[model samples]
Target: MTMIFGIPIQAFLGQLLVGLINGSFYAMLSLGLAIIFGLLRIINFAHGAQYMLGAFIGYLLLADLGIGYWPALVLVPLIVGLFGMAVERFALSRLYGVDQLYGLLFTFGLALVIEGVFRYYYGVSGQPYAPPPLLSGGTNLGFMFLPNYRGWVVVASLVVCFGTWALIERTRLGSYLRAATENPRLVQAFGVNVPLLLTLTYGLGSGLAGLAGILAAPVYQVSPLMGSDIIIVVFAVVVVGGMGSILGAIVTGYVLGLAEGLTKVFYPEASNIVVFVIMALVLLVRPAGLFGRDG
Candidate 1:
Protein backbone atom coordinates (compact mmCIF):
# COMPACT_ATOMS: atom_id res chain seq x y z
CA MET A 1 0.00 0.00 0.00
CA THR A 2 1.31 3.40 -0.90
CA MET A 3 1.80 5.83 1.96
CA ILE A 4 1.92 9.59 2.16
CA PHE A 5 3.71 11.29 5.02
CA GLY A 6 4.03 7.92 6.76
CA ILE A 7 0.26 7.44 6.73
CA PRO A 8 -1.39 4.82 4.59
CA ILE A 9 -2.74 6.28 1.38
CA GLN A 10 -6.17 4.81 1.92
CA ALA A 11 -6.36 6.22 5.42
CA PHE A 12 -5.19 9.60 4.18
CA LEU A 13 -7.78 9.59 1.42
CA GLY A 14 -10.50 8.59 3.84
CA GLN A 15 -9.64 11.43 6.16
CA LEU A 16 -9.40 13.84 3.29
CA LEU A 17 -12.88 12.90 2.13
CA VAL A 18 -14.22 13.30 5.64
CA GLY A 19 -12.56 16.69 5.82
CA LEU A 20 -14.18 17.79 2.59
CA ILE A 21 -17.54 16.67 3.85
CA ASN A 22 -17.07 18.59 7.06
CA GLY A 23 -15.73 21.56 5.19
CA SER A 24 -18.94 21.64 3.20
CA PHE A 25 -20.93 22.16 6.34
CA TYR A 26 -18.52 24.73 7.65
CA ALA A 27 -18.55 26.61 4.40
CA MET A 28 -22.32 26.67 4.21
CA LEU A 29 -22.79 27.72 7.80
CA SER A 30 -20.07 30.38 7.77
CA LEU A 31 -21.22 31.61 4.43
CA GLY A 32 -24.61 32.36 5.93
CA LEU A 33 -22.95 34.08 8.85
CA ALA A 34 -20.86 36.19 6.53
CA ILE A 35 -23.87 37.27 4.53
CA ILE A 36 -25.91 38.18 7.59
CA PHE A 37 -23.10 40.13 9.20
CA GLY A 38 -21.93 41.73 6.01
CA LEU A 39 -25.12 43.63 5.28
CA LEU A 40 -27.02 43.66 8.54
CA ARG A 41 -23.97 44.29 10.72
CA ILE A 42 -25.63 42.04 13.22
CA ILE A 43 -23.88 39.13 14.90
CA ASN A 44 -26.55 36.47 14.64
CA PHE A 45 -26.11 34.23 17.64
CA ALA A 46 -29.41 32.51 16.83
CA HIS A 47 -28.13 31.09 13.54
CA GLY A 48 -27.41 27.71 15.09
CA ALA A 49 -30.90 27.52 16.48
CA GLN A 50 -32.24 28.31 13.05
CA TYR A 51 -30.20 25.41 11.67
CA MET A 52 -31.58 23.09 14.34
CA LEU A 53 -35.05 24.24 13.43
CA GLY A 54 -34.42 23.29 9.82
CA ALA A 55 -33.43 19.71 10.65
CA PHE A 56 -36.31 19.32 13.05
CA ILE A 57 -38.70 20.71 10.50
CA GLY A 58 -37.36 18.27 7.93
CA TYR A 59 -37.77 15.40 10.38
CA LEU A 60 -41.32 16.46 11.18
CA LEU A 61 -42.15 16.66 7.51
CA LEU A 62 -40.77 13.21 6.87
CA ALA A 63 -42.27 11.57 9.90
CA ASP A 64 -45.66 13.26 10.07
CA LEU A 65 -46.38 14.90 6.75
CA GLY A 66 -44.86 12.10 4.64
CA ILE A 67 -42.73 14.57 2.76
CA GLY A 68 -39.56 13.09 1.36
CA TYR A 69 -36.06 14.56 1.48
CA TRP A 70 -36.31 15.97 -2.01
CA PRO A 71 -39.34 18.07 -1.26
CA ALA A 72 -38.22 18.97 2.22
CA LEU A 73 -35.02 20.36 0.75
CA VAL A 74 -37.07 23.00 -0.98
CA LEU A 75 -39.81 23.47 1.59
CA VAL A 76 -37.72 23.55 4.74
CA PRO A 77 -35.48 26.35 3.63
CA LEU A 78 -38.39 28.38 2.39
CA ILE A 79 -40.29 27.93 5.61
CA VAL A 80 -37.30 28.72 7.76
CA GLY A 81 -36.30 31.63 5.60
CA LEU A 82 -39.73 33.16 5.82
CA PHE A 83 -39.68 32.63 9.55
CA GLY A 84 -36.34 34.43 9.68
CA MET A 85 -37.74 37.32 7.70
CA ALA A 86 -40.50 37.61 10.21
CA VAL A 87 -37.92 37.60 13.00
CA GLU A 88 -36.00 40.41 11.40
CA ARG A 89 -39.12 42.40 10.71
CA PHE A 90 -40.56 42.09 14.20
CA ALA A 91 -37.58 41.69 16.49
CA LEU A 92 -34.21 42.36 14.93
CA SER A 93 -35.40 45.32 12.95
CA ARG A 94 -36.19 47.11 16.16
CA LEU A 95 -32.53 47.12 17.12
CA TYR A 96 -30.98 48.54 13.99
CA GLY A 97 -30.20 51.98 15.38
CA VAL A 98 -29.38 50.70 18.84
CA ASP A 99 -26.06 49.44 20.13
CA GLN A 100 -24.59 46.48 18.30
CA LEU A 101 -24.57 44.58 21.57
CA TYR A 102 -28.34 44.82 21.61
CA GLY A 103 -28.59 42.86 18.41
CA LEU A 104 -26.11 40.28 19.69
CA LEU A 105 -27.91 39.89 23.00
CA PHE A 106 -31.26 39.59 21.28
CA THR A 107 -30.01 36.82 19.04
CA PHE A 108 -28.32 35.06 21.94
CA GLY A 109 -31.52 35.10 23.90
CA LEU A 110 -33.43 33.94 20.88
CA ALA A 111 -31.05 31.00 20.54
CA LEU A 112 -31.61 29.99 24.15
CA VAL A 113 -35.37 30.26 23.76
CA ILE A 114 -35.37 28.19 20.59
CA GLU A 115 -33.11 25.51 22.06
CA GLY A 116 -35.17 25.41 25.24
CA VAL A 117 -38.43 24.96 23.41
CA PHE A 118 -37.07 22.10 21.33
CA ARG A 119 -35.41 20.44 24.31
CA TYR A 120 -38.62 20.59 26.27
CA TYR A 121 -40.33 18.55 23.61
CA TYR A 122 -37.56 16.41 22.11
CA GLY A 123 -35.77 15.50 25.36
CA VAL A 124 -32.28 16.03 23.91
CA SER A 125 -32.20 12.69 22.14
CA GLY A 126 -30.98 12.41 18.57
CA GLN A 127 -33.75 11.58 16.13
CA PRO A 128 -32.84 9.40 13.20
CA TYR A 129 -33.36 10.66 9.65
CA ALA A 130 -32.71 8.40 6.73
CA PRO A 131 -31.43 9.64 3.43
CA PRO A 132 -33.72 9.54 0.44
CA PRO A 133 -34.05 6.16 -1.24
CA LEU A 134 -32.26 7.27 -4.38
CA LEU A 135 -29.22 8.34 -2.38
CA SER A 136 -29.06 5.50 0.11
CA GLY A 137 -26.20 3.48 -1.33
CA GLY A 138 -22.42 3.88 -1.62
CA THR A 139 -20.18 4.22 -4.63
CA ASN A 140 -16.94 2.33 -4.96
CA LEU A 141 -13.94 4.31 -6.19
CA GLY A 142 -11.46 1.38 -6.16
CA PHE A 143 -9.51 2.98 -3.34
CA MET A 144 -12.16 4.54 -1.13
CA PHE A 145 -15.88 4.01 -0.97
CA LEU A 146 -17.91 7.18 -1.10
CA PRO A 147 -21.39 7.38 0.29
CA ASN A 148 -23.78 8.74 -2.30
CA TYR A 149 -25.50 11.04 0.15
CA ARG A 150 -22.21 12.41 1.43
CA GLY A 151 -21.05 13.07 -2.09
CA TRP A 152 -24.29 14.86 -2.81
CA VAL A 153 -23.75 16.99 0.27
CA VAL A 154 -20.27 18.05 -0.85
CA VAL A 155 -21.52 18.92 -4.32
CA ALA A 156 -24.63 20.67 -3.12
CA SER A 157 -22.70 22.77 -0.66
CA LEU A 158 -20.18 23.81 -3.28
CA VAL A 159 -22.96 24.79 -5.60
CA VAL A 160 -24.70 26.80 -2.93
CA CYS A 161 -21.49 28.54 -1.86
CA PHE A 162 -20.36 29.51 -5.31
CA GLY A 163 -23.83 30.31 -6.43
CA THR A 164 -24.22 32.69 -3.50
CA TRP A 165 -20.83 34.21 -4.23
CA ALA A 166 -21.78 34.78 -7.83
CA LEU A 167 -25.10 36.24 -6.85
CA ILE A 168 -23.40 38.75 -4.60
CA GLU A 169 -20.34 39.49 -6.69
CA ARG A 170 -21.82 39.38 -10.16
CA THR A 171 -25.48 40.21 -10.08
CA ARG A 172 -27.33 43.55 -10.13
CA LEU A 173 -29.37 42.69 -7.03
CA GLY A 174 -26.10 41.94 -5.33
CA SER A 175 -24.96 45.39 -6.31
CA TYR A 176 -27.90 46.90 -4.46
CA LEU A 177 -27.20 44.78 -1.40
CA ARG A 178 -23.59 45.92 -1.36
CA ALA A 179 -24.69 49.49 -1.84
CA ALA A 180 -27.17 49.27 1.01
CA THR A 181 -24.51 47.82 3.26
CA GLU A 182 -22.28 50.72 2.46
CA ASN A 183 -24.94 53.42 2.74
CA PRO A 184 -28.51 52.44 3.46
CA ARG A 185 -29.63 56.07 3.52
CA LEU A 186 -28.18 56.78 0.12
CA VAL A 187 -29.69 53.63 -1.34
CA GLN A 188 -33.03 54.53 0.19
CA ALA A 189 -32.82 57.89 -1.52
CA PHE A 190 -32.58 56.08 -4.81
CA GLY A 191 -36.00 54.44 -4.21
CA VAL A 192 -34.48 51.07 -3.38
CA ASN A 193 -36.35 49.76 -0.36
CA VAL A 194 -33.39 49.52 2.01
CA PRO A 195 -35.33 48.16 4.98
CA LEU A 196 -36.88 45.53 2.76
CA LEU A 197 -33.45 44.68 1.49
CA LEU A 198 -32.16 44.16 5.02
CA THR A 199 -35.09 41.91 5.82
CA LEU A 200 -34.52 39.88 2.68
CA THR A 201 -30.80 39.60 3.31
CA TYR A 202 -31.38 38.24 6.80
CA GLY A 203 -33.95 35.86 5.42
CA LEU A 204 -31.53 34.67 2.76
CA GLY A 205 -28.85 34.07 5.34
CA SER A 206 -31.19 32.14 7.64
CA GLY A 207 -32.49 30.13 4.73
CA LEU A 208 -28.98 29.02 3.92
CA ALA A 209 -28.61 27.83 7.49
CA GLY A 210 -31.85 25.91 7.19
CA LEU A 211 -30.71 24.31 3.97
CA ALA A 212 -27.51 23.18 5.67
CA GLY A 213 -29.48 21.71 8.55
CA ILE A 214 -31.67 19.70 6.21
CA LEU A 215 -28.58 18.38 4.42
CA ALA A 216 -26.99 17.45 7.74
CA ALA A 217 -30.10 15.66 9.04
CA PRO A 218 -29.15 12.30 7.59
CA VAL A 219 -25.43 12.59 8.26
CA TYR A 220 -25.76 13.69 11.88
CA GLN A 221 -28.67 12.88 14.10
CA VAL A 222 -31.42 15.47 14.16
CA SER A 223 -30.86 16.72 17.64
CA PRO A 224 -31.31 20.10 19.26
CA LEU A 225 -27.69 20.03 20.47
CA MET A 226 -26.33 19.44 17.01
CA GLY A 227 -26.24 23.10 16.05
CA SER A 228 -24.51 24.21 19.23
CA ASP A 229 -21.85 21.55 18.82
CA ILE A 230 -20.93 22.70 15.32
CA ILE A 231 -21.58 26.43 15.58
CA ILE A 232 -18.48 27.15 17.70
CA VAL A 233 -16.19 25.58 15.17
CA VAL A 234 -18.00 27.52 12.47
CA PHE A 235 -17.56 30.73 14.42
CA ALA A 236 -13.87 30.03 14.55
CA VAL A 237 -13.99 29.55 10.83
CA VAL A 238 -15.73 32.91 10.44
CA VAL A 239 -13.19 34.62 12.68
CA VAL A 240 -10.28 33.17 10.75
CA GLY A 241 -11.88 33.97 7.42
CA GLY A 242 -12.81 37.47 8.54
CA MET A 243 -16.37 38.16 9.56
CA GLY A 244 -18.51 39.66 6.80
CA SER A 245 -16.18 38.53 4.04
CA ILE A 246 -18.09 36.24 1.74
CA LEU A 247 -15.14 34.66 -0.06
CA GLY A 248 -13.06 34.60 3.08
CA ALA A 249 -15.70 32.63 4.91
CA ILE A 250 -15.91 30.06 2.13
CA VAL A 251 -12.16 29.53 1.86
CA THR A 252 -11.44 29.46 5.60
CA GLY A 253 -14.16 26.94 6.28
CA TYR A 254 -12.76 24.36 3.84
CA VAL A 255 -9.15 24.99 4.80
CA LEU A 256 -9.78 24.65 8.54
CA GLY A 257 -11.89 21.56 8.01
CA LEU A 258 -9.06 19.86 6.09
CA ALA A 259 -6.60 21.02 8.71
CA GLU A 260 -8.73 19.57 11.46
CA GLY A 261 -9.11 16.29 9.62
CA LEU A 262 -5.34 16.05 9.09
CA THR A 263 -4.80 16.80 12.75
CA LYS A 264 -7.04 13.90 13.69
CA VAL A 265 -4.85 11.62 11.59
CA PHE A 266 -1.52 12.89 12.92
CA TYR A 267 -2.24 13.98 16.52
CA PRO A 268 -5.50 12.68 17.80
CA GLU A 269 -5.11 14.46 21.10
CA ALA A 270 -4.95 17.91 19.52
CA SER A 271 -7.69 17.36 16.97
CA ASN A 272 -10.23 19.21 19.03
CA ILE A 273 -7.99 22.18 19.77
CA VAL A 274 -6.34 22.48 16.39
CA VAL A 275 -8.98 24.85 15.05
CA PHE A 276 -8.80 27.05 18.11
CA VAL A 277 -5.04 27.04 17.98
CA ILE A 278 -5.16 28.17 14.42
CA MET A 279 -7.71 30.83 15.34
CA ALA A 280 -5.36 32.11 18.03
CA LEU A 281 -2.50 32.21 15.58
CA VAL A 282 -4.61 34.03 13.02
CA LEU A 283 -5.68 36.53 15.63
CA LEU A 284 -2.08 37.20 16.58
CA VAL A 285 -1.00 37.72 13.01
CA ARG A 286 -4.07 39.46 11.64
CA PRO A 287 -6.63 40.51 14.17
CA ALA A 288 -9.15 41.35 11.46
CA GLY A 289 -8.87 37.79 10.09
CA LEU A 290 -7.37 36.41 6.90
CA PHE A 291 -9.75 38.31 4.62
CA GLY A 292 -11.11 40.87 7.04
CA ARG A 293 -10.41 44.50 6.31
CA ASP A 294 -8.76 46.47 9.06
CA GLY A 295 -11.31 49.10 9.97
Candidate 2:
Protein backbone atom coordinates (compact mmCIF):
# COMPACT_ATOMS: atom_id res chain seq x y z
CA MET A 1 0.00 0.00 0.00
CA THR A 2 1.22 3.50 -0.79
CA MET A 3 1.28 6.24 1.84
CA ILE A 4 0.93 9.99 1.57
CA PHE A 5 2.23 11.85 4.60
CA GLY A 6 1.74 8.69 6.67
CA ILE A 7 -1.84 8.33 5.51
CA PRO A 8 -3.03 6.15 2.67
CA ILE A 9 -2.90 8.03 -0.61
CA GLN A 10 -6.42 6.87 -1.33
CA ALA A 11 -7.67 8.38 1.90
CA PHE A 12 -5.84 11.62 1.33
CA LEU A 13 -6.82 11.97 -2.27
CA GLY A 14 -10.39 10.94 -1.57
CA GLN A 15 -10.74 13.69 0.96
CA LEU A 16 -9.01 16.08 -1.37
CA LEU A 17 -11.53 15.29 -4.09
CA VAL A 18 -14.36 15.81 -1.67
CA GLY A 19 -12.85 19.12 -0.69
CA LEU A 20 -12.56 20.19 -4.31
CA ILE A 21 -16.18 19.27 -4.93
CA ASN A 22 -17.39 21.22 -1.93
CA GLY A 23 -15.15 24.05 -2.94
CA SER A 24 -16.78 24.20 -6.34
CA PHE A 25 -20.15 24.89 -4.81
CA TYR A 26 -18.68 27.26 -2.28
CA ALA A 27 -16.82 29.24 -4.89
CA MET A 28 -19.83 29.58 -7.19
CA LEU A 29 -22.27 30.48 -4.43
CA SER A 30 -19.98 32.91 -2.67
CA LEU A 31 -19.01 34.48 -5.96
CA GLY A 32 -22.64 35.35 -6.50
CA LEU A 33 -22.91 36.79 -3.01
CA ALA A 34 -19.76 38.80 -3.46
CA ILE A 35 -20.93 40.15 -6.80
CA ILE A 36 -24.29 41.34 -5.54
CA PHE A 37 -22.88 42.88 -2.40
CA GLY A 38 -19.91 44.36 -4.20
CA LEU A 39 -21.87 45.96 -6.98
CA LEU A 40 -25.38 46.43 -5.71
CA ARG A 41 -24.43 46.97 -2.08
CA ILE A 42 -27.31 44.66 -1.13
CA ILE A 43 -26.70 41.71 1.11
CA ASN A 44 -29.02 39.13 -0.39
CA PHE A 45 -30.31 36.67 2.12
CA ALA A 46 -32.53 35.19 -0.61
CA HIS A 47 -29.54 33.91 -2.56
CA GLY A 48 -29.73 30.43 -1.10
CA ALA A 49 -33.41 30.30 -1.78
CA GLN A 50 -32.69 31.31 -5.34
CA TYR A 51 -30.27 28.44 -5.56
CA MET A 52 -32.94 26.09 -4.29
CA LEU A 53 -35.32 27.52 -6.79
CA GLY A 54 -32.87 26.78 -9.57
CA ALA A 55 -32.60 23.13 -8.62
CA PHE A 56 -36.33 22.87 -8.29
CA ILE A 57 -36.78 24.46 -11.67
CA GLY A 58 -34.46 21.95 -13.25
CA TYR A 59 -36.19 19.05 -11.55
CA LEU A 60 -39.57 20.31 -12.59
CA LEU A 61 -38.47 20.82 -16.15
CA LEU A 62 -37.28 17.25 -16.34
CA ALA A 63 -40.33 15.86 -14.64
CA ASP A 64 -42.95 17.91 -16.41
CA LEU A 65 -41.57 18.50 -19.85
CA GLY A 66 -39.07 15.67 -20.16
CA ILE A 67 -36.35 18.26 -20.40
CA GLY A 68 -33.04 16.77 -19.48
CA TYR A 69 -30.22 18.11 -17.33
CA TRP A 70 -28.42 19.40 -20.40
CA PRO A 71 -31.27 21.70 -21.27
CA ALA A 72 -31.81 22.74 -17.67
CA LEU A 73 -28.15 23.48 -17.30
CA VAL A 74 -28.66 26.62 -19.33
CA LEU A 75 -32.41 27.12 -19.10
CA VAL A 76 -32.68 26.99 -15.33
CA PRO A 77 -30.11 29.67 -14.70
CA LEU A 78 -31.68 31.90 -17.31
CA ILE A 79 -35.07 31.38 -15.73
CA VAL A 80 -33.75 32.09 -12.27
CA GLY A 81 -31.87 35.08 -13.60
CA LEU A 82 -35.06 36.48 -15.03
CA PHE A 83 -36.83 35.82 -11.74
CA GLY A 84 -34.08 37.65 -9.91
CA MET A 85 -34.32 40.48 -12.38
CA ALA A 86 -38.03 40.73 -11.74
CA VAL A 87 -37.42 40.77 -8.01
CA GLU A 88 -34.92 43.56 -8.40
CA ARG A 89 -37.17 45.53 -10.71
CA PHE A 90 -40.35 45.30 -8.70
CA ALA A 91 -39.42 44.52 -5.11
CA LEU A 92 -35.76 44.97 -4.30
CA SER A 93 -35.49 48.14 -6.29
CA ARG A 94 -37.93 49.79 -3.93
CA LEU A 95 -35.72 49.19 -0.93
CA TYR A 96 -32.66 50.79 -2.43
CA GLY A 97 -31.35 54.13 -1.09
CA VAL A 98 -32.41 53.04 2.40
CA ASP A 99 -30.59 51.46 5.27
CA GLN A 100 -28.85 48.29 4.07
CA LEU A 101 -30.44 46.48 6.97
CA TYR A 102 -33.73 46.91 5.22
CA GLY A 103 -32.38 45.13 2.16
CA LEU A 104 -31.06 42.36 4.37
CA LEU A 105 -34.33 41.95 6.22
CA PHE A 106 -36.32 42.07 3.01
CA THR A 107 -34.24 39.34 1.43
CA PHE A 108 -34.48 37.27 4.60
CA GLY A 109 -38.25 37.53 4.47
CA LEU A 110 -38.16 36.68 0.80
CA ALA A 111 -36.13 33.57 1.46
CA LEU A 112 -38.52 32.46 4.16
CA VAL A 113 -41.47 32.97 1.89
CA ILE A 114 -39.88 31.07 -0.97
CA GLU A 115 -38.75 28.22 1.24
CA GLY A 116 -42.13 27.97 2.89
CA VAL A 117 -43.87 27.73 -0.45
CA PHE A 118 -41.60 24.95 -1.61
CA ARG A 119 -41.88 23.08 1.66
CA TYR A 120 -45.63 23.31 1.54
CA TYR A 121 -45.68 21.80 -1.91
CA TYR A 122 -42.76 19.36 -1.98
CA GLY A 123 -42.57 18.41 1.68
CA VAL A 124 -39.14 18.07 3.34
CA SER A 125 -37.92 14.87 1.83
CA GLY A 126 -34.91 14.79 -0.47
CA GLN A 127 -35.45 14.21 -4.15
CA PRO A 128 -32.70 12.81 -6.30
CA TYR A 129 -31.80 14.10 -9.74
CA ALA A 130 -29.85 11.71 -11.87
CA PRO A 131 -26.68 12.77 -13.58
CA PRO A 132 -26.48 12.57 -17.32
CA PRO A 133 -25.43 9.20 -18.78
CA LEU A 134 -22.13 10.56 -20.00
CA LEU A 135 -21.22 11.45 -16.44
CA SER A 136 -22.38 8.20 -14.92
CA GLY A 137 -19.16 6.41 -14.06
CA GLY A 138 -15.77 6.77 -12.44
CA THR A 139 -12.33 6.70 -13.98
CA ASN A 140 -9.07 5.23 -12.76
CA LEU A 141 -6.41 7.90 -12.79
CA GLY A 142 -3.61 5.58 -11.67
CA PHE A 143 -3.40 7.03 -8.14
CA MET A 144 -7.09 7.57 -7.52
CA PHE A 145 -10.59 6.98 -8.81
CA LEU A 146 -12.49 10.00 -9.95
CA PRO A 147 -16.19 10.14 -10.66
CA ASN A 148 -16.86 11.71 -14.01
CA TYR A 149 -19.65 13.86 -12.64
CA ARG A 150 -17.64 15.14 -9.74
CA GLY A 151 -14.69 15.85 -11.96
CA TRP A 152 -16.96 17.63 -14.37
CA VAL A 153 -18.27 19.73 -11.53
CA VAL A 154 -14.82 20.83 -10.44
CA VAL A 155 -13.71 21.65 -13.94
CA ALA A 156 -16.95 23.34 -14.83
CA SER A 157 -16.87 25.47 -11.74
CA LEU A 158 -13.29 26.50 -12.30
CA VAL A 159 -14.17 27.54 -15.80
CA VAL A 160 -17.19 29.43 -14.62
CA CYS A 161 -15.30 31.16 -11.82
CA PHE A 162 -12.45 32.30 -14.01
CA GLY A 163 -14.76 33.18 -16.85
CA THR A 164 -16.88 35.32 -14.57
CA TRP A 165 -13.79 36.92 -13.11
CA ALA A 166 -12.61 37.72 -16.57
CA LEU A 167 -15.97 39.13 -17.57
CA ILE A 168 -15.90 41.47 -14.60
CA GLU A 169 -12.22 42.30 -14.61
CA ARG A 170 -11.23 42.39 -18.25
CA THR A 171 -14.23 43.57 -20.20
CA ARG A 172 -15.69 46.87 -21.30
CA LEU A 173 -19.06 46.13 -19.71
CA GLY A 174 -17.36 45.30 -16.45
CA SER A 175 -15.64 48.64 -16.45
CA TYR A 176 -18.98 50.34 -16.83
CA LEU A 177 -20.33 48.21 -14.02
CA ARG A 178 -17.53 49.10 -11.63
CA ALA A 179 -17.83 52.72 -12.63
CA ALA A 180 -21.54 52.64 -11.97
CA THR A 181 -21.07 51.20 -8.54
CA GLU A 182 -18.46 53.77 -7.71
CA ASN A 183 -20.41 56.66 -9.12
CA PRO A 184 -23.91 55.86 -10.28
CA ARG A 185 -24.78 59.51 -10.70
CA LEU A 186 -21.81 60.17 -12.94
CA VAL A 187 -22.56 57.12 -15.06
CA GLN A 188 -26.20 58.02 -15.29
CA ALA A 189 -25.37 61.52 -16.39
CA PHE A 190 -23.23 60.06 -19.15
CA GLY A 191 -26.36 58.39 -20.63
CA VAL A 192 -25.83 55.03 -19.00
CA ASN A 193 -28.92 53.57 -17.39
CA VAL A 194 -27.64 53.00 -13.90
CA PRO A 195 -30.86 51.46 -12.64
CA LEU A 196 -30.82 49.03 -15.52
CA LEU A 197 -27.28 48.11 -14.72
CA LEU A 198 -28.17 47.55 -11.09
CA THR A 199 -31.02 45.27 -12.07
CA LEU A 200 -28.78 43.32 -14.44
CA THR A 201 -26.04 42.99 -11.84
CA TYR A 202 -28.46 41.50 -9.35
CA GLY A 203 -29.77 39.23 -12.07
CA LEU A 204 -26.26 38.06 -12.91
CA GLY A 205 -25.49 37.29 -9.30
CA SER A 206 -28.75 35.41 -8.90
CA GLY A 207 -27.99 33.59 -12.10
CA LEU A 208 -24.68 32.42 -10.68
CA ALA A 209 -26.43 31.05 -7.62
CA GLY A 210 -28.91 29.38 -9.90
CA LEU A 211 -26.08 27.83 -11.86
CA ALA A 212 -24.63 26.47 -8.62
CA GLY A 213 -28.02 25.05 -7.74
CA ILE A 214 -28.57 23.06 -10.92
CA LEU A 215 -24.98 21.92 -10.80
CA ALA A 216 -25.60 20.69 -7.28
CA ALA A 217 -28.87 18.93 -8.10
CA PRO A 218 -27.36 15.65 -9.25
CA VAL A 219 -24.75 15.70 -6.47
CA TYR A 220 -27.17 16.34 -3.60
CA GLN A 221 -30.83 15.89 -2.95
CA VAL A 222 -33.22 18.48 -4.24
CA SER A 223 -34.61 19.47 -0.87
CA PRO A 224 -36.25 22.57 0.43
CA LEU A 225 -33.82 22.62 3.33
CA MET A 226 -30.91 22.42 0.94
CA GLY A 227 -30.53 26.19 0.81
CA SER A 228 -30.69 26.68 4.54
CA ASP A 229 -28.31 23.80 5.14
CA ILE A 230 -25.40 25.17 3.11
CA ILE A 231 -26.16 28.87 3.09
CA ILE A 232 -24.57 29.70 6.41
CA VAL A 233 -21.30 28.15 5.32
CA VAL A 234 -21.42 30.10 2.08
CA PHE A 235 -22.03 33.32 3.99
CA ALA A 236 -18.99 32.50 6.05
CA VAL A 237 -17.06 32.06 2.83
CA VAL A 238 -18.13 35.51 1.71
CA VAL A 239 -17.16 37.09 5.00
CA VAL A 240 -13.78 35.41 5.01
CA GLY A 241 -13.23 36.48 1.42
CA GLY A 242 -14.39 40.02 2.03
CA MET A 243 -17.96 41.21 1.55
CA GLY A 244 -17.52 42.76 -1.88
CA SER A 245 -14.42 41.13 -3.24
CA ILE A 246 -15.09 38.96 -6.28
CA LEU A 247 -11.69 37.32 -6.57
CA GLY A 248 -11.53 36.92 -2.84
CA ALA A 249 -14.74 34.91 -2.81
CA ILE A 250 -13.51 32.49 -5.43
CA VAL A 251 -10.08 31.90 -3.88
CA THR A 252 -11.22 31.68 -0.28
CA GLY A 253 -13.99 29.25 -1.19
CA TYR A 254 -11.68 26.67 -2.77
CA VAL A 255 -9.02 27.03 -0.06
CA LEU A 256 -11.42 26.68 2.86
CA GLY A 257 -13.06 23.73 1.20
CA LEU A 258 -9.72 21.96 0.93
CA ALA A 259 -9.06 22.81 4.55
CA GLU A 260 -12.40 21.36 5.60
CA GLY A 261 -11.86 18.17 3.62
CA LEU A 262 -8.40 17.63 5.10
CA THR A 263 -9.76 18.21 8.56
CA LYS A 264 -12.31 15.48 8.05
CA VAL A 265 -9.51 13.12 7.17
CA PHE A 266 -7.19 14.08 10.03
CA TYR A 267 -9.63 15.23 12.72
CA PRO A 268 -13.12 14.04 12.04
CA GLU A 269 -14.45 15.79 15.12
CA ALA A 270 -13.58 19.22 13.76
CA SER A 271 -14.56 18.71 10.15
CA ASN A 272 -17.90 20.38 10.34
CA ILE A 273 -16.78 23.41 12.32
CA VAL A 274 -13.40 24.01 10.73
CA VAL A 275 -14.69 26.60 8.30
CA PHE A 276 -16.34 28.53 11.09
CA VAL A 277 -13.21 28.45 13.22
CA ILE A 278 -11.22 29.92 10.38
CA MET A 279 -13.95 32.49 9.86
CA ALA A 280 -13.79 33.51 13.51
CA LEU A 281 -10.07 33.91 13.33
CA VAL A 282 -10.27 35.95 10.15
CA LEU A 283 -12.87 38.15 11.74
CA LEU A 284 -10.73 38.79 14.78
CA VAL A 285 -7.58 39.40 12.81
CA ARG A 286 -9.15 41.47 10.06
CA PRO A 287 -12.61 42.77 10.68
CA ALA A 288 -12.57 44.19 7.20
CA GLY A 289 -12.07 40.62 5.95
CA LEU A 290 -9.09 38.95 4.29
CA PHE A 291 -9.75 40.61 0.92
CA GLY A 292 -11.72 43.60 2.14
CA ARG A 293 -10.32 47.09 1.96
CA ASP A 294 -10.46 49.07 5.15
CA GLY A 295 -12.78 52.00 4.86
For model 1, residues 86-130, the per-residue Cα lDDT tens digits are 999999999997898999999999999999999999989999999
Off by over 4 Å in 2: none
- The estimated TM-scores of all candidates read 0.98, 0.98
The local distance difference test score of model 2 is: 0.95
RMSD of each: 0.9, 0.8
Which parts of model 1 are misplaced by more than 4 Å?
Answer: none
Clashes of each: 0, 0
In candidate 2 the C-alpha lDDT for residue 273 amounts to 98
**Candidate 2 lDDT trough over 10 residues, lowest sum:** 90-99
lDDT of 1: 0.94
Cα lDDT, all candidates: 0.94, 0.95
